[model samples]
Target chain A: MKLKCIVIDDDIHAINGIKSYLNTLSNISLYKAYTDPLQALTDITGGANVDVIFMDVDMPMISGIELSKAIRHKTSKLIFTTSHSKYAYEAFEMNASAYLLKPYTFARFAETLNRLFPQSPSLPNISIQQEEDYFFVRNKNEKNSLIKVRYSDIVAVESLQNYVRIYTTNETIVTYIALSEIKIILQDYPNFAQAHRSFIIAKNHIEKVEGNTLKMVNNLTVNVGNSYREGIQEYIKEKTIRTSRS
Target chain B: MINIKKSPPFIRIQNWLAYKKFHIIIWLVFMLYESVIVGLFSGQFGNLINYILFYSLNISMFYVHTHIILESGLKRKNQIWWKLPVLLSLELLVYLMIYIGFDYLITDILKYFRPRKIGMTMQYILGPVYRAIYFMFFSTGYYFLLKFLSERKKTEELEHQRLNNMIQIARSENAFLKAQIQPHLLFNTLDFIYQNARDHSPIAAETILSLSEMMRYSVDSNKDKDFISLGEEINQVENLVNLHQLRKHHQLQIRFWYDDDIKKVEIIPLILITLVENIFKHGNLLSQSHPAEIKLYLQNNDLIIETSNQIAKVKEKPGFNSGIKNITKRLAYAYGDQSTFESGTTEDNYYKVRVTIKVKHTID
Candidate 1:
């Protein structure tokens, strides 16, 4: 028997990312997806049952924290997905089964799912490419010399003083590589843009842009620097056209 | 009552001696001296020795009397007019009693030493009479000088107390006014932007513009001690609420009513802001089916602001981390007992607050 799963998130990019990661596992079946919590509540109370729910913390009409509480009496397992890492502790407080941060990788997603369902199907091997469309991350301790990542799967690359935090659809990888290096490597991607001094965000994940700051679908926002605003604006314009076509 | 843990033995004794009236030691000393030594003395000692003993006892009595009667334990105004003269006169009267007492001894001794001396009886009779007159003159002079000293001490204490009270009043008023004005304006601007985000993305931009304007003015004006018009405060509120109403998708209606007369009244820069901040922090209009209502006006020199809203029932304690409480403390400090503030939650979960302050212009 397959383990059925549901995702409740208002952000389209986050929902799609989760969907893409789910394709790797054979036994886990995607049951339903909800953007509006009110509609999702109706669907749940009206008899849509699932093994686990991947919930977001922040949303427009109804907050993820409130929704989790409202549905806690009915279900036992809830996996929280969020862009803001601040919500990770809050998820555990809500008694969630797992927490998946935004722009997470397939291997991290597989680990979380494996913990929940012991007999789950094995994920396929993912290879990294080294072209402008791909990025290489070297982990010294691991047997693998260079891990390849697809540019499209990346949501943002956050700078942490000495290192950069690369966020993909399913995994978050912290590399010793500088943000400037990563920015140069992924600069050609239509969705890639540097929104803050410490942040390079994927244009596709942007839900709302206010003033010089842009709020991503992962419920995270990055500021567009005065110096880099012109470049980001062009990237956002181009991505908007591409997304609209898709 | 008293905090015994903090009080030391010496302090307790000093406090008791200074404050407690009609100390038993003073009366006991008078009674014991008269009963024991005066009754027992037969004038065996010379006249100089007798005067020395009498003056020494009086000096000790005067020291205790000066500390108790003149120096008040309260550290404020004190009077010892009646005590100084009364204590001095009593000393002189004791001196006269002892002088007369010496006559009994002198007469007996004269019988032995100057049996044949002429007019001894006349000398004995005049001796006490002269001493009594001398004591009265000196007591009266000392009485006036002590009175002058005690009066000076009292005035100095009064001046110190008055200065301390004035400084406290000024500090509290300044704090209260800052509490009232700062946070209210801040949250109102926040509400405006939040509401604007609901209507149009561009409205959020506009909200930011207004917020920046308010913030810039606040930063500048906070540096100055000048009073601002109540009318200007109301105008700022109008702009904020109007902007908020635009962004609210739910038909959350906000009704505002205020006294036009108060518009001209000059108020401490931030008094109205505290109430507004309270309203916005607790008010949740998104979930409510009906619109929230707010009313503002001045009645009997007090600013009365009333606002009502139906918000989601928050499960946790709505804990007071806000600056409103500081403002309340400040208002009371600034206005003394002249201002009144009342707040409580209703059965419908609608929180209401009424704050009244007695308006008065600065004299200088």
Candidate 2:
């Protein structure tokens, strides 16, 4: 099914720019565009089945942050577009799916969409490895060679276009597999988490948490994406050692 | 000069009498005392009437000398040296003749009424002359006293008016400075243009957006406000770096690292941005191997920012150092002795600046 999206910005030119970009993509359909934020709020609150929303931070009558909070429960994905990067923190606080800076290229826009709705219907061959501690995938470099990746030995999975680079404890494997397929197959595992747009990390491998970055056991520093920060923060809070002065 | 026409006659009279009331009261008391003393010495109640008459005559002579002679003579330039003395003596001689005629007239009238011989001795004429001179000296002192006091009052009034004018000028200047164009309107208009250009020309749209962001930061940060959140300043710094990168056609290498939790910390605005702006102006950011780097973090309740860039071989503009000077001045003003700011060139020709500010918890 094509994702249903709406664009709301006080600037008509900005709405048209986003509309033009969305028109080029086949998987997402632009249902509506709004220049008046109050009308958009009324429509969304009146039970519009919108799958995603592209909102501007600064708007007349109501701020984008305030509107996001008011209608957050009605939509599944929320993406904030703003000229100022300072709103990134507030966007994260509102649990937005992505924060795109103004004048972003089409590629950057597609990257955020892919991360939000990875497992589309076009990729129907993905399947979860149930009742097992390991999965097998074919390597891209050496055809016909199948590699066994133990769930416990997996440190992280990084996406590079159509290929997935699996970092294991002893060696690395480059497989001819989509990141969405791997993400679907590993959906049942609670220990692995998507940390960034191009990265999925194992919770046990996180050695240190510093600001918006995480250091893994293999000394790889992965930046935490704005949308996934809250979950990572909750995980860190649970494991952090609390100290008090006597 | 006094603007006598501005005050009404009644108010002027009230003011004059109020000013001279002390002297008038003192003169009346002295005359009454002299009358009683003379009456007691002569053992005659009739001496009281004589003392009253004498004092009244003396007051008339004093007014004639001061108002008619001194004023009319001193007002003219050539009459002040010689003509003034001649005018004063002639007026005094006329006053003496009138006094002698009045005294003889009074003695003759009394002798006719009582049918008794009244003594006309040399003592009577000389006593009246001596008293007349004494009263003239008193009038001269009083005239100079009034002149000195009025001049001081005029100067005091002028000084008060000048101070009031200065305060009015300062207030208007402050209002003029605060009346700059609102930043929100400028940014909104720029955003409209950016949207229109993005479809056909993405690069142009990006440039407009970046320029608008930089302009918004510089204009919207109210200089009068004391503190701003660090997160907002960081965003502006990033926009500055992006704009400079576009200026060099994406060849400039820059890296910025900031602690996410420090977003809420309040700081004196524009200090970090100024240091980064200086790097773009004078530092060699084109070096791929050694990119200009900015790092901000908190260390033990202090907000610390460090920036380092390679020094360019080209000579900088004469006023390029003013950015750093302004930052130091602002830091000193806000933090006083609590903040530390240092900048120097390393042996490897890398320009570096480090600033550490003591953060207070009360700022929200």
Candidate 3:
């Protein structure tokens, strides 16, 4: 079962960052979003379908904690996404599924998602072992070390020299694997998309769309290449339309 | 927690007994003097008048003598041997004149009174002269004895104070030595863990666990004293050495030795560790082509630790810095006159340091 999530925050960049990262995790399906917590509360309480809400603690009309408590009778799971560790204890008290600290990497994002959606017997332990859906790879320099990166943990792949540097939530692992091979392997995953020739960003990680360009959760801008711009635009417009319909 | 009322009974009883004896003797002598003087000076009206004058003279003399003695900073022997002779001679001359004048008055005013019958007048000259000498000796002796007892008491108090000061200094030094050891141990162990952590070696987690264990042991065990048993301290050092030895490709040659008996004895905690650190700090800078030798040994109830490394040859020679001088100061403070430290370059281009500290049996 997928986690039906929503982004309720005032800061566009933060909301975008969370949206981009959530795109990479197939299990975390974004349902509805609102810039204002009051409006988001009205929509959620007024019969919106949301299982888990990724709420920001700092909001203008109502705080994420306050909104979560207000909608406690409605939603099942509430995950707090903020930059402060001070609110972590408070978030847990509110029965939050997870508290995602800001400036988090893709690996940390995946780890949080794995906790939110617990594994059943049928779903193999892809975190501990590589399944047919994903594969773990690292550079020759990191292969023998403890710095190995799994495909599920890779937020983006950047082509550098004869190596493709795989950026994870924890650290980056650069390997001699061809970018074509990465693109081919990750093509089937809903979260992975070749936004540019040099970059294959996790589609779930798309934070904002300005015309043809896409900003990632890390505030890094990836050009929506002429070929992939149409597909990227369609995916974002469809998400907005679906949320409005819901 | 502190039992203040538990002072030994013997000390309290001794103090009370001494105080009672001192006051009792003073009161007895005062009463005896008053009785003897009152009897000798009361006979007739003429005698009574004469007695009043004699009594006044004695009182004046007593006041003057006591004032001089109490205010004088002179030693008891000087007051007895010199001041008494001068003061008595001066008082005697005045008394002699008074006596001669009184004799003339008795002869002129009392013509009916026989010279033989005037016993009070006859006894005045001889009695006063003899009494004057006797009183001076008595007072001076008493004053000197009290001064001697007070001086002895003060000397004992000062000795006790000196011993207490020494103990406080030893305790503080022990504390400083402990601080020095713990920080240095922490630095080296953290550095070892960091080396593994930076490489992202799978063993980094194990190194962290080992590092935590070492830290827990250091904080828990080294709370009381600056030094631990030689065997225990060496084990900590060995753990650090083993970390480097595990990465043997560095080809670092480390030799450690200590007497089997010395293992039970305790030495300053960080002394040997500092020597090891200095060896690594200097040896790592040396040409890798040349082998480094660090030798630590115990002999003759003294910790003899030495580390030698080939100096990195460069035209711009570095001067002596604070780290070595600091160790020297710490050693001096820890052992005082009981430690010897030497550092220099050998003719064979090897820089060496030799530190020797006498082992002390620490009370567990």
Top candidate on DockQ is 2
- Docking outcome class, model 3: incorrect
Q: After superposition, how far is residue A209 of candidate 3 from its true place, in Å?
A: 21
**Per-residue accuracy of model 3 over B225-296 as CA lDDT, tens digit each:** 766777676656655554553333213444443334446767767766666666665554324235454444
The model with the greater lDDT, 1 or 2, is: 2
Off by over 4 Å in 1: A1-246, B1-98, B106-122, B155-237, B242-284, B287-310, B316-364
lDDT (Cα, tens digit) per residue for candidate 1, span B131-248:
4544344333334445665687899999999999999999999997786555545543443443344234533544454454355345435445555677767756655664554344
Better of 1 and 3 by TM-score: 3
DockQ of each: 0.01, 0.12, 0.01
Clashing pairs in 3: A20-A204, A20-A205, A20-A206, A21-A205, A23-A204, A24-A204, A105-A169, A106-A169, A107-A169, A191-A203
For model 2, report the TM-score of its A chain. 0.51
Candidate 1 chain B minimal-lDDT segment of 10 residues: B1-10
- Shift in Å, residue A21, candidate 3: 36
Alpha-carbon shift of residue B147 in model 2 (angstroms): 16
Which candidate order results from sorting by TM-score in descending order? 2, 3, 1
Q: What lDDT score goes with residue A112 in model 3? A: 65
| Candidate 3 chain A: 10-residue stretch with minimal lDDT | A120-129
Please give, for residues A210-246, the per-residue lDDT of candidate 1 as tens digits.
8766876655556565557898887667656454454
What class would a CAPRI assessor give candidate 1's docking?
incorrect
* Better structure of 2 and 3 per DockQ: 2
Runs of candidate 2 with Cα error greater than 4 angstroms are A1-11, A18-30, A34-246, B1-184, B362-364
